[model samples]
Target chain A: MVAISDLKKISEYEWEIPQSFRADMRVPVRFFVTRDLLEQALRDASLEQAVNAATLPGLVGHVTVMPDMHQGYGFPIGGVAATRYPQGVISPGAIGYDINCGVRLLGSQIEAEAAKPRLDVLATALNKYCPSGVGQGGALKLTERELDAICVEGAEWAKKRGYASDADLRRTEEGGRLEGADPAKVSPRAKQRGRPQIGTLGAGNHFIEVDVVEEIFDEEAAQVMGLHAGHLALQIHCGSRGFGHQICSDYVRAFQGAVKRYGIQLPDRELVCAPLDSPEGQDYLAAMRCAANYAFANRQLLAHWARQAFEETLAGGVKNWHLHQIYDIAHNMGKVEEHVVDGKKLKVCVHRKGATRAFGPGFPGLPAEYQKIGQPVLVPGSMGTASWVLVGTEGSMQRSFGSTCHGAGRTMSRSQAKKQIWGEDLRKELEGEGIHIRTGSLAGLAEEAPAAYKDVDAVVETVTGAGIARKVARLVPLVVVKG
Target chain B: MFTLTTTYQRNYKGSVTWGVGCDFQLEVLPFFVGIGKIRYTGKTMVTETGYREIEHTADWELEVWAPNLSSLLETAARGMYALAQMQLVDGERESREFEIPFGDRESLLVDFLAELLYLGEGEGLVMDEFSFTFDGNTLKVRAWGAPIKNQSKEIKAVTYHRLQIRETEFGLVVNLVFDV
Candidate 1:
């Protein structure tokens, strides 16, 4: 176990564990966290896992962990690592099982005061339109050929089918489609799983939330993002479902042998990896991209259904019920990009497991209107807590690998939460607070209790204080649909 | 009913004995470790295999133990089903038979569970009766169950994090972490 004495304090919001802490580590581990959050992280194995991640071969700079860090399977949640391109390795476990699991925010002009009366109807419509729960398939059953198309085309495929608009594509990360997605690389079993699960909000921490913009910190940035205080906004959180899970499982299993063949030694088997130049590495990357694209299309389809739900509930009753896309950002992904490392521009693969890419202002990838500002960073809180909207900063590019915290990380185990909190009681409490709740399983609700996670506001304060991200707006949930 | 007939007997403490006949086996050992501990009652009529949940902040961890690899696999499957709150409806029994090319013990364990997860999610099947035959470099499994009636949560994948099948004094013990 790592203690606070092992760390070198850099600032109030920053700390470092030097490479000397472990002989096997190739690089140091940098932490963007408040002292309180760091103490919370020490209570778990997250810091130790981050230390293990630092042992990956060909790692550049340092392994960066966000303030909302928690213990994940192999890699710590809220971890970011950049490896030298072409020769460096990519670990499937580092990118996570839910490939491209992300958040999409949609802003609308519908005022919360005017829509209060029909909030329940809107919640019901959202639940009815969006298929959720364990093993729930979406409305569309695509053929193998169409599934292949979705693999390559991503949200563009949805746009062609009238599920997305042009602006929706532009505002999404990587335009909601990752290039070089090869369906041939994905396993047949993965394709079979992907066929029916597209456009679904599968269970376990995935939710579609209706929120009212509670406060605006950056007025200009909020206006550019079409976010208005006291207005309604929707947040969709999900991923590629079983398709991605199977793909990740297939590769993780395959890489267990790859690590042996390449003679790469690691402390943890789950941190298995292959050199980017290897055939195994290339195939996994291709398959992973397919899953990422599938997720983009999945969220796009959900957004379309959410729009219909809004229209159905408030079409004639409200004047402007349209929900425009704010931004869709993926927290779990591996991308090949150029970044300044050691004052030199180097191409690297940034593996962000539970961290969002927070590219600073003037990055070429941002949409035209967001070029002056930065890419939007969506940090969802636990259910019934305040979610935040932040933007990238230049400090993020210099210190970290252009990444920020993903959400309010879990502090309590599911079993513990379930034991301590009752789902019925939580539901009644939230409903009493005027938050509409729709869910399939109350047990799942108990597992996701707000007490299970850290405070989101404190997490945001740490990041903004560290100058890695700037807060734009705060959102309070009014309706939450969980699977 | 899956008939279980006694095949072996043991009198030593901490020794594992098995009653095997039909699709399932009744494993008896002196003592069980981890979650639900089963004590030696001297009569050898109760199950010794068991699993229990461990505290993990972001995912599920299960500590499972049994007399052998086959019993360990079955117990782990039961633990996973319990974690997901999966229930099967009363109906005609369905069975699935398949072979997994064995690499290592850990890989085989993961592959076996992954296969079960696929079946549960894709085919809506949950197996309670399991028979395993280990040949040269291969594992043949026959599982019997009914269609799933309800499942509260979904486990995204079974992870290889710190997965090691250890030989204990009593039996085999392993810790499995699941991505939920």
Candidate 2:
């Protein structure tokens, strides 16, 4: 474990672990958190993990971890690193197992008051229309040919099928499709696992929430996102499903040797990497993009299903259900982006594992509609807690390469949470808080109890405090559907 | 045929059972270190739906049995390198020490193995053999190997999801489910 004393206080919200601490480190390690939260984060080896990530080959700037950072497989969740493009190494572990495991938010026309009475009906419709749960399969089953298309085109595939709108595709990161997705690079087993799971929410912390926009902090930004105070909204949190998981697993195992071939010495095995220009690195990146596209399509289809469920359950053909895609962003992904580093316009592979891309205004990626307001950052809170909507700031690009916190990070482990809370009782407690939940298993529910996480409000406070992302609105959940 | 029942239960989550058919009752863990017993049977392997099916690996492959999922996974991990005739060294040599941390249990196991590989390659420690103790979620293990000799398989970092280690009445069953 890295001693807390080794952490140099950079600011009230920033702490740094200098590269001098480790000889192999290419960059320093920086963490964003409040003093109290910093203490909690240190309870586990997440800081150590962050420090270890700093030692990867070709890393640039400091290995920056967001406030939501937690111990993850190879890299800590909410971790960010920008490695020199082409020559910099890419670690499958750094990208994570659930590749493109991200959150997408949709805003509807219905107001909170009007939607409250019919919450149960909406929840039931969503649960039925959107398949969720462990080992659950979706209604749409794709053949190998179609699956390959889905992997390649991502949201574009959904748009072609009329499941997505042009506007929806425009607002998504990378226009909802990343470049260089080579399906052939994805193994058959990974394809097999993904073939049946599209449009389904797999188990473990993945959820679909029906929330009411409680408050709008930035009116101009809210208007651009079609979000208003009291507007009913839907937030879908999932990934490329078994497909992404398998792809990452397959590559992480494959790259174990690439580290040696490249003569790279990492502080942790989880940071195993291959040079971006190398054949192995190129193949893994391609495969990772396939998973990213799959996740985009997966969420797009879920949105379609959600709209259908609303139309079926409510009157007026659910015309009141104006579910506009606010924005979809990839949190766990590595993208080759051009950024200014040390007064040089250098291309780098920015890996945002369990972190969100917070591109500010004037970036070319956003649709014309959102170009003025900047990227819509979705920060989903813990179950039964308040989530937030933030917009990227110019300060973000200058500082953390246009990246920000992903969600309310965890404060406790699953076991620790389970030992302290009961599944049945926790259900009752959430319901008492006026949040309705339907879960596949009670134990899973207990493991995800709100107390198991840090306060979303506080985490958001740190980001806004640091000026990386500015608050736009706050969302309070009315009903939740968990897988 | 022998009937193998693998059960997984979370104190808070649901439990699942997977059945495999083999012809043997393996000696459970704590019974022996390297070898275990298997009673051969003639019955067929059954699926969750109760339909019998044919399997090749279970029918003829050699499996090292343990009592729990951790040991099962450990030995399975060991089995991968053991096949290479990797030699074990005494833990007496005081070498570089580092901490391996993971997000979850399965990733923890992967990190454990990766640590051994790193020692073998990075620090010049030839890791041919190792043993581990699971204290809750943390693992502390002793590994043996000569100084870094040459490259073996490039073992990357471990993952956390879809990891399975099951205990059965017959013996321990571990699934080497890798993301890669």
Candidate 3:
């Protein structure tokens, strides 16, 4: 176990574990956490896993962990590591099983005060329109050919099909489509799985929630993102479903042999990886992008259905009831990009697992309106709490590869949470607080009880204090749909 | 369940035993080492085939011990269904079979469970009876079930995260971690 005494403190919000602490580590491990949260992380394997991640080959800079870090299987949940491109290594486990599992925020002009009376109706409509729960299919059924197109076209496929608008595509990350996605690289079993789950919200912590913008910290940034105080916004949190799962599983299993072929050694078998320039790595990257694009289209379609739900519930009740896309960003992904480290511009593959990309101002990827500001970083809190909206800063680019925390990370195990919290009682409590709750399973609900996670406000404070991200707005949930 | 003598067995304190009693198996390496042949129970080794839920921090983990590989696979399937809270329908039984080319043992394990998940989600079908046969690296699975009448959870994927299939002193032991 790693003791706190071994850590080299950099600042109140930053700390480091030097590479010399572990003989195999290629780079040091950096911690973006408060002292309190660091204590919590010490109780679990999050920090140790972050240290393990530092051992990956060709790692550049530090293995940066966000404040909302938690213990996961191969990699810590809120981890970001960049590897030099071409020859650098990419670990499928580092990217995660749910490829492109992301959050999409849609801002609306509908006033929360005016829509209060119909909150339950809106929740029901959203649940009815968005097919959620275990084994549930989505609103649209696609053929193999169409699924192939989505692998390449992403949200643009949705746009052409009238499920998305030009403005919606503009605000999305990479215009909601990744380049060089090859459907041929994705396996047939993945295609079979992807065919049926286009807009569905699969089970386990994935959710669709309606919130009211509680407050705005950056007025100009909020206005540019269309976030208004006391107005309604919707957040859809899901991923590539089984398609990405199979792809990752396939590549990870295949890479077991690849690691042997490449003559690379790791502490954990789950951290199996290959050089980016290798044939195996190229194939996995291509397949991964297919899953990534598929996820973009999945969220885009979900956004369309969400819009439909809003219109059905609030049409004629309010002057306008449309949900415009704020931005869609992947928390789990591997992106190839150029970044400056020590005044050297190098291309690298940034693997962010349960961490959001927070590109600072003037990157040229942002929509014109957001160029002055930075990329929107959506940090969802636990259910029935305040979710934060933040943007990247220059410090993020310099120190952490432009990535930040993902959510109020889990502090308790699911078993512990379920044992301590009753699902029925949790539902009643949230309902009493005027938060409309729709869930598929009570047991799952108990597992995700708000008490199971860390303090979201404190996590945001750490990131903003560290100068990695800037807070823009805070949101309070009115309705939550979970599967 | 029939006990196969082909697998290894250990006698401890003159009792039969099988199960992964940990709430969550520690990291991957120590899990197998920590519990191998060093039976904590003063009484041990019942020689029956069964499975148990081990504690996992984020996802569901299961440990299955049997007298052989086929029975271990069966027990692992049952454990997975139990983890997902799968329930079957009355009145009708549905059957599906999988005959596929095999790779490694771990890959075979993941593919088997993934097939079951695919059936459960895509067609609402599940398994009831089990027959796993291997012939020249070809796996044949024959099973029966009906459309899922009720289910509480969904497993996103069967992962290779610290997956280990062991031929231990207590027959064949396999630990599986699932992504939910």
Top candidate on TM-score is: 1
Give the higher-TM-score candidate: 2 or 3. 3
Expressed as tens digits, the lDDT of each residue in A323-411 for candidate 1 is 99999999999999899999999999999999999999999799999988899999999999999999999999998889999999999
* Chain A only: TM-score per candidate: 1.00, 0.98, 0.99
Q: B11-81 in candidate 3: lDDT tens per residue?
A: 11122334433322222321111121232222122335655556666777777778787787777777787
**Candidate 2's residue-wise lDDT over B65-88, tens digit each?**
455545554455454343221333
Clashes by residue pair, model 1: none
lDDT of each: 0.91, 0.74, 0.86
Ten-residue region with minimum lDDT total, candidate 2 chain A: A412-421
Docking class of 2: incorrect
Candidates' TM-scores? 0.94, 0.77, 0.91
Error of 3 at A311 (Å): 1.3
Query: What local lDDT score does residue A400 receive in model 2, on the 0 to 100 scale?
Result: 89
lDDT (Cα, 0-100) at A370 in candidate 2: 81
Docking class of 1: acceptable
DockQ values for all predictions?
A: 0.44, 0.05, 0.32
Best by lDDT: 1
